[model samples]
Target: MPVVDIPGSKSITARALFLAAAADGVTTLRRPLRSDDTEGFAEGLAALGHRVGRTPDAWQVDGCPQGPPAREADVYCRDGATTARFLPTLAAAGHGTYRFDASPQMRRRPMLPLTRALRDLGVDLRHERAEGHHPLTVRAAGVEGGEVVLDAGQSSQYLTALLLLGPLTRKGLRIRVTDLVSVPYVEITIAMMRAFGVEVVRETVLGEDVFAVPPGGYRATSYAVEPDASTASYFFAAAAVTPGGEVTVPGLGEGALQGDLAFVDVLRRMGAEVSVRPDGTTVRGTGSLRGLTVNMRDISDTMPTLAAIAPFASGPVRIEDVANTRVKECDRLDACAENLRRLGADVRTGPDWIEIHPGASAAAGAEIKSYGDHRIVMSFAVAGLRVPGISFDDPGCVRKTFPGFHEAFAAVRAGLPG
Candidate 1:
């Protein structure tokens, strides 16, 4: 058994940065992720005239109580979607002119839903180069925030961006979200907001969620981020795929805020033994992997991780209700299907679902194309544990979230039994 210490949650870290920047006083984030996404968020905040300082133990962020310092600035979000989507809402909360741009890949992702919601809230926004994509400008005088409706079917980040700014609005904020995908992430956003001293009132009206947030904005506080459960999935899958193998991801247990922690249940349904201790959660192989159909909408981030292990299952694995994954850093659904096929698995893909039949023999050596997606790179790396000669075309792509993923993954591999 290998006890692995994973990094902090990217989702929580990103949300904390936004909330801290918006709060009235100084806020400290302990054990926050230091990868590309989190760093990009910190940089974006600094560019807005907020003071963000890094120390060995933690990072301290000084809030812009009145509003953003800069009246006009250009933020380069790079490939971080959280930075790209969330910062614009923060920018709109201030009196400024802000332009957000990202990597070419991010330019292709959807942003209209959030932009439309911002417009509804009376923030002046424009798509500088593309109609519904990034490279957009926001001329802000702060949000009016009366009432707005959004279709969050594509990505939860849209809902989250607005939700983060809910309490900061002039007349408070009311949002109705239809076709919501990744509801767990929305829960994370609400929970984090509460941690910063604001409560979001949520109710279901005719199968749609209506959220009410009052005008009292967030108050700064010290927050500690839990280890990233999404990153833990690969190691947990490692245990599920290896006979007599066990891996413990420390610091993620029953009380963890991340929704992706439910991924262990998916492993449990596949016949792996899982235990939740006070310190962490551990997954142990039972010498059998059973494939089962599952709806991964809540934990869709783990879809590729599960897909990597599907070929070794005793039956076919079908994942459904994750059409949202198509609009990620890349078309993850297609990337997973194509990479699985490349590995010689019997794979079929739909607009939203993917079916993978167990392969009788391991495929020959092949290089998995990463598509510059970190999840894609890491998920397929787990498959390499069982299928030899599995190498990556862009192994460095994991730097987006987990910079030391390959080194950590190799340590996990080294601890496994032959």
Candidate 2:
């Protein structure tokens, strides 16, 4: 058995940063993730004239109660979609102009839905390049925020951006969500907002989901981020793939805020034993991996983890209802099919689902192309635990979320029998 001390949640760290910056006083974030995405967000916040101090243990952010000091600022988001999508709304709360740019991969991701919602809230935004893409400009005099509708099918970050900015609006904020995917992430945003001393009212009105936020903005407080469940999925999948193997991810237990923690239930359904305590959660393989048909819409982040273990299972594995996964760091559905095929698995892919047949044998020293997606790299690494000669083309891409992923993974692999 290996105990993995995984990094903090990237989602929670990002949201906590945004909420802290918008709050009325200083906030301390303990054990926040120190990766490219979160660091990029911290940089963006600093560019807006907010003070961000870093220490070995925590990050102290001086909240901008009234608004950002810079009338105009250039925020570079790198490849972090969370930074690109969420920061624009925070910038809009200030009285100034903000230009946002991202890596080519992130620019290809959808931002039109969120930008459109900002425009509806009376923030002047212009897409400098093609429509719906990044390299956009936001000219802000603060948000009017009456009523707006957004299609959250592309990414839950869109709705989360609006909700984070809701309290700063003049008339408060009322949002109608249509085709909302990743509903659990929205819940995460609301929960974090509540911790920052803001309350978001969520209700269903005539079959549509609506969220209401009053004009009283956030108040700063100290917050601690839990270990990233999405990152923990790799080690958990390793345990499920290796017979009699067990891995414990501490600090992410029954009361964790991340929705991706539900991934353990998926492992449980696949014949793995799961134990949850207040301190941590552990998963052990039953020596028999059972393939299952599951809709991973809410927990789509773990699709690659499940796919990595699917080939080692006793039956066919069918993953469905994750069409939103197509628009992630890459077309993950296609990437999973191609990489699985490269590893000699009989994988079939549709517009939304992937069906992997039972038998999978490694093509001698199979090399997996990560397509610059961190999840793709980590997932395939889990498969390597079972099949020998598994290597990655772009192993460094894990730095986007977990900079020490390979090192941590090596620690887990050290416990595996040769």
Candidate 3:
């Protein structure tokens, strides 16, 4: 087995950008993830007047709290959802019209709840094309902070939008969430904000999604983003499900704010040895894996890795508590099941759960389909190392998050052919 060390996560990078942009001083982020999404953020921040630079493994952002005064302008996020959602709210803070649009992929994402909530509180944004979806122009009417309900079950980005814009609003914002699925991501936003000198107080209402954010711009600070736990989950899974070996990931220790970091526990339960480090982490594969049942509500980003490794276990591996996985990049649960089935693993899936019967090794060189999802491709590609003749439909899709995912895979492989 080969040892692997991957770069940090885009999720952490994006959060770092938000924090850096809100801070008053220049923030330097080391090992920041580079991708279309992060680039879009840099572009969006530049549009709002923040000076940013995309350097090797790091980013420099100079933030001005009062600079991006909302103006009558449109910011096109292209295919970047973070940019599409977060930039509009930032723009709305100032007095002016701003329109947010995206490419075909991002254009299909639902934005109704955020828009409706903003409109209700007083954002002057209207869909130039279809309602709920993008291609809309904002008339820049400042929304007074008030109670707004959001259906975050579709995507956590909507909730993140409100949380990010909280400090800029005149009054503190309280959002009552209904059917919010990706609650962990909200916690991620809150944790990152607090690191950069902003805090969002969360009050849990049983059977409801309710969160509150105080009024104030994120206090500018030099905050470094933690390594991406989600990115490390795949390699950790690789170590666990393999016949023998280990993988070490740095910068993710015990009690990381990222919900996906909990995936290490899932690995340990499956009989893998996990070592936590101050700036990194390590995972060693146990010779054999026991099929386990798990709930993934908090660690949905690790769904692909867990599902890919499930078939290698001795018993049935069942993953539950994550219906939100259906919307990311693609219908991940459905896609993983379909592709794994193609590779000769027996798998069953539900709206919120998946049951996998582990017995045989994945077939070699099956030319699996990625469904245009980067996670699907990356996890399954790692699976291919164990299975003979493994290939992906769109090997290039990993650029969405890990721009050098293949290189990282190759880096870990040492001499293994890509």
Candidate 4:
């Protein structure tokens, strides 16, 4: 058995940083993910005059319930959507003039929904280049929160940003969401908010989902981040596609907070033996890979992971209801299809789905176009296991989430037999 020790969750670390910055005292976060995205978030906080201390294994953030200490700040949000979206929202709670910008790719992603809602709440915000896009400024006098409506169909990060800003307001926030995708991510945000001493009331009123967050901001505490389940999917997929191979990832058992952990069930349904215990989760290959259709709306981050291994399945593998993936680091549905065909798999992709047929091993060697998306590089690395001579155009893009992925994955591959 090959036990792959995965790193901490990026989503959890970002939220923890936000909560700690908003709390009333010092907050220590254990095993936080150190990546481009997270480091960018911490830097954004520091630029806004929040105190953050870092070590090899942990991070310490001093709370500021009165909001950011700086009266003027200019934050560059790199490629992290959480930093781009959440940091501006965090700055809105303070009395300052905060200018926010991002890289070309991050600048291209949508920011209208969250920015519109903030404006509706009496925030002075202006878009410098594009409307509802980055390169914006917030002349924050402070938020006196009230009922606001939102549409989170394109991404759930909008809802998460707003929810994080709720408690920092004077009157709290009652958000009425018109649409939502990746519901589990919102659940993660709400649960973490509860941990930081805020209870968000969620209910369905007249057939619409609503979240009511109370005022009186977060309370600082020590929090531990679990192993990233999405990152674990690549290793587990390696086990499922290799003959007589087994891989175990610790710290993502039954009670794991991330919905991406449910990717194991998808592997299990494809003829892999899965074991989820209190300590960890394990997947063992049965050497018979079957295929079926799976709806991956709530767990869409792992869509590329499954798509990469679909070429090895015995039947057609269809993944559906993941349109939001189009707005990720790249158009993931199309990216997966393009690479699958490059490897000689019969592949088709619609707006929200992709289907792959088996026996794609005919191609000799193909270089995968990474599109600067970490998931694209990491997912196809699983495909590289059974299919020989697979390479990447930009393997270093994994620095966005898992900086040491190539070495870690190479070590695991050395221990497993294909």
> lDDT rank, highest first?
4, 2, 1, 3
Which candidate would rank higher by TM-score, 1 or 4? 4
| Tens digit of per-residue lDDT, candidate 4, span 256-327 | 899998999999999999999999999999998899999999999999999999989999999999999999
Per-prediction TM-score: 0.98, 0.99, 0.92, 0.99
lDDT of 3 at 303: 85
Residue 234 in model 2: lDDT: 95
Cα lDDT computed for each candidate against the true fold = 0.91, 0.91, 0.77, 0.94
lDDT of 3: 0.77
Of 2 and 3, which scores higher on TM-score? 2
lDDT digits (tens) for residues 1-418 of candidate 3: 4545566667777777876776667888888777878787777787766778767867888875653643555576867778877777777776666667887877777788788878877888888788987888777655578788888877788889888877777787899888776667888888888877776777778777677888767666655666677777777776676545667776677667678877888888888887876666777776877888898877788888988878888899999987878867678899999988887888899988998897545555588898778889988876776677888889998887778778787666553323
> Which runs of model 3 end up more than 4 angstroms from their true locations?
1-5, 67-72, 205-209, 360-363, 414-418
* Pairs that collide, model 4: none
Give lDDT for model 4: 0.94
- As a whole number from 0 to 100, the lDDT of residue 358 in candidate 2 is 83
- Per-residue lDDT tens digits for candidate 2, residues 8-113, read 9999999999999999999999999999999999999999999999998899999985567689899999999999998888999999999999999999998889
| Residue 95 of model 2, lDDT score | 94
Instruction: Give lDDT tens digits, candidate 1, residues 1-418.
Output: 8999999999999999999999989999999999999999999999988899998659999987556889989999989999999999899999989999999998999889999889878889999888889899999998777889999999999999988898788888899988788988999999999998989999999988899988878899999989999999999999999898999998999888889999999999999999987789999998899989999999999999999899999999999998999999899999998898888899999999999999835556788989999999999999998888888889999999999999999999999877
lDDT of 2 at 124: 90
Worst 10 residues of 1 by lDDT: 359-368
